[model samples]
Target: MPSHERFRTRREKMLGQLRELFLAEGFASFSIGDLAERFRCSRSTLYAVAPSKEQIVVATVRSYFKTGAERIEARVAASADPAQQLAIYLESVASELQPASATFFADLADFGPANEVYQENTQYAARRVQDLVTQGVKVGVLRPVHASFVGAAVAEVMGSIQRGAIQEATGLDSAQAYRHLADLVMTSLADPKKPAHERRAT
Candidate 1:
């Protein structure tokens, strides 16, 4: 007689539990054993989805970027003005960075090392931003700057705003930092619907 299986749909259940755990714990100090125990599975079961702990962390980061990209797309779709859409998109990113874990940040600190999956996800996020800028430019809704340059500038400004926000949500620095940077970046990227001064006044 063949042995019976105790856990049907195990992979889905495990992955679901993994997502939940990631959201709750924010990807700090995680391991396959913890996931296995959470899902009541053997450690070997984790190897099926991820080869190492770093792979699991990278996957979690990828998951975050993927969901974040979806939200940005939805926000962009709902907005009319290309400038407003870009501002909203950038500000949304600054806001989103607040909930990320320190461990996630630490993992990212090592991202420049020779890590394929990690690098891939980071590049994917950057490419998404560049692609959006490229589309806006092609449609004549954005300035003709290089997409890569604009994307890098956007990332840098957003990071600055996020760091400033992390300090305290008071004073003009916190309340208006990201907004101000968004205005600067978007004004430069906006279409020729209005004069530069008028767009800046916005």
Candidate 2:
């Protein structure tokens, strides 16, 4: 393999371990020294992938969300049924975020750069969601409401959920909150002509 590809492969391997650690223990507690000791790698090896601890955190979070968006979009495009696509896309989002802990998100909110990465992803997500809703409306699977309004509202709620507001309002954790949100949105947006059983199953 080429040197760059080899390096990227190594970095992705290391990032998998780091992402698990961050999700389980939170990002605020670990330092480069701690990471090196925990992962059984030298400081130079860690530095080769991420020059600093904050950069590592940002990169890990970005990777997690980026891959999640890709999977959700692919699922959305997999079917011709608009109702099914909506269900799959939203439910996929909940599944993707189910592993994150409160502490992991709290740290992201406090870290400006990492938080910006999140914001950018959320903006992209909003656009994707809007497009899906528009398609649904065009096909008559969803009600004719303003697509921008629905998309923006859902994205705002998701942002609040990430910031731990959902946990504060309800005793549910982030993952549970996402599941509930997906259910609620799907129920409201699902085509009335579709059988209830089908919508629920989707």
Candidate 3:
């Protein structure tokens, strides 16, 4: 590859490694020197990724969420059923977030730039849930409930989860909380008059 291509490839690799490190141990405690040592690279090399520790954390967090959203969408796209789509979306989100340690979330909340990325992702998730709910109702798989209302409620719960309130209140981690939310949404949308198999489809 050309020199620029080589640099890009190495940078991408470094970002992926940094993302995993942050997810497992959080970023707030790691300085640029620490990260450089961890990666066996010079400070200048790390600086190529970002100018400072905070910027690096922000970039890695953003990259992690971006990759997660793409994966979740791909999983949801594989299922044709509207109800299954909703389930897959939420479950996929949980699965994607399962590797993140509590420390990582705490650090994310403490960092303004990183927290902004997280907040934006949460907002997008709320909108996606609303769209899925609307689709389910249109196809008669779900009851004719108000999609926007359901979306808003899910958004509130999601915000609470992101802020550590859900963990404090229920002793459930973010991933487990999402799974429960998926179950709750599916159960509430199931039509009682339908046959068991049909209901199960939802």
Tens-place lDDT digits, model 3, residues 1-202: 8999998888888899998999999998888888888989998888778888888888899999999999999988888988888988988989999999999999988999999999999999999999999999999888899999999999999999999999999999999999999889888987677775765433
Cα shift from native, residue 94, model 3 (Å): 0.6
The TM-score obtained by model 1 is: 0.57
**What tens-digit string does per-residue lDDT give for candidate 2 at 1-202?**
9999999999998888878887777888888999999999998878876888888888898888887888887877888877678778778877877787778878888999888988887777767778878988998888787999988988998888777788889988877877787788788887788788877535
Model 2 residue 65 CA deviation in Å: 1.0
Instruction: Write one digit per residue (lDDT tens) for candidate 1, span 84-138.
Output: 5666666675555555554444445455431344445435545656777787677
What lDDT score is found at residue 85 in candidate 2?
81
Question: Native-vs-model 1 lDDT?
Answer: 0.59
Better by lDDT, candidate 2 or 1? 2
Lowest-lDDT window of 10 residues in candidate 1? Answer: 1-10
User: lDDT, candidate 1, residue 144?
Assistant: 83
TM-score of each: 0.57, 0.93, 0.95
- In model 1, the Cα lDDT at residue 16 comes to 55
CA lDDT of each prediction against the hidden true structure: 0.59, 0.82, 0.90
